[model samples]
Target: MPITTNGIHHEERGSGDRTIVLLPGFGCSIACWAEIAPLLDGYRTILMDLPGHAGSVGAHADGDLPTLAETVYDACREIGLTRFIVAGLSLGGAISMRIALDHPDEVEAVLGIMPWNAGGTSAGDPVIEGFNAAYGDIETITAGITSISNDPTKTTDLLHTMPTVTEKMWRGWLGGGAFTSMADKLPGLRVPAFYLVGGKDFVVNQAKQIDDVRSIPGGRLVLHADLGHLACYEEPELVAREMLNFLDTHAIAPA
Candidate 1:
């Protein structure tokens, strides 16, 4: 795995003209992209483990969103990618938004999955609070992840393969502060964007999620009715097809 200054670990594949950067959610690693990557074989893809997760343990800078976004930007710069389409899931979506907002010149488009939007408190507040409360115990946190993942067996296997983090690291990430700060910046995005959410995602209000991103000039929403928060895992082929179509429609360079 290649390492970045901010402690992210990544794997690069393909040699296409267009680059697709995959950012996983909390507690997940590059392994989260296992199913999606093969579908994007024609495009250059970069899958990264966020700090303190998987191969990037001990690389945590600040749990805050801006710092994490800068880390992502640095990683992309290090890899010689001047611009790319960023596709992020959950927490990754929040980071992608920050990157798109802070580095518009380097972002061609954004695909936000179950994204956390800019709002101090909305219908999703209780969901976030529940997550924070559960983060007090690692077992609880793990269980929560398993409950939400589309494939519990695969998700558990992937998680069990990673290096463990301290309670503080887990708590800091799930405490909700970082997401709150990230969500507060949604209204300022200027790039073309796609917002995706599983139709069955109870953790986030799908209607609100769509409405939030729809407010952006060129943003549109796509809902996978049969999937949940882990839509990518539950419906990789469908998600991949939708993403590829979006890219094609936006005239994003192919890998």
Candidate 2:
């Protein structure tokens, strides 16, 4: 793992010409995708830590969604990444879509795992609102994490990362347009997109997410009736298999 001069920490893993950039959810680091990355042995994976998280050093509260998106994009460019598949979870999911929408030529495809926009563009998702309401409350975040996660060990790991979260980042999520709607833009999306959400998700509205994906051109949705918000961590095998299937269907073969 290496931290760039700009303070964006990233690591390249696996092998192949085609690359898949993996972005972690809010308050998560590259370790969030540790298990799933290896499963995608056919493609190289670039794991990144967003500003104000883990090894990265920056103030997220100072920027909005586009700003953060550009931060990630610039970091990728610094790493010499050109065209690649951008994939992420929760907050990361929304950023990935934004990146795809803004740079269709560079982002070959996008995969959003329970993206933030899935909860509708209105006031805010109940889950996200609750987080905002209980900003910096450990018990609240812990309870929320426990409720959405299926694996005990994964839950523990997530809890351990909580201390690194800054109040400014939390505020950024509120005022920085982290939950802003991209509904109008999805209809004009140029690249292929696939969205995966758990039917029992308490964080993002699954039905709304389905409709969101449908709006995109050649968009596909995968529903896991039994999974929750952290489906990838709970069941890495199932998630990876579905992801690989999507890639295969689209003829995105390993380089």
Candidate 1 per-residue lDDT, tens place, 1-255, comes to 588776778898776778989998766677667788888857899998776677778676446667778888888898788989898887788778878989988898888777665442353466566666764466766767776776676566435632264445566655633455444456677677887778677666676676677566777777777777777666778778888878888646535
Top-scoring candidate (TM-score): 2
Give Cα-based local distance difference scores for all models. 0.72, 0.79
C-alpha lDDT (0 to 100) for residue 66 of candidate 2: 76
RMSD of each: 2.8, 2.1
**For candidate 2, lDDT tens digit of each residue in 1-255?**
587767788988899778999988887777778899999968999999877778774534343677778888888898999989999988889889989989988998899887776334456557667766766678988887787777656657677675576677767775456556778888989888998888777777666788888798889988888877887678888878887888878737436
Cα RMSD, model 2: 2.1
**lDDT winner among the candidates?**
2
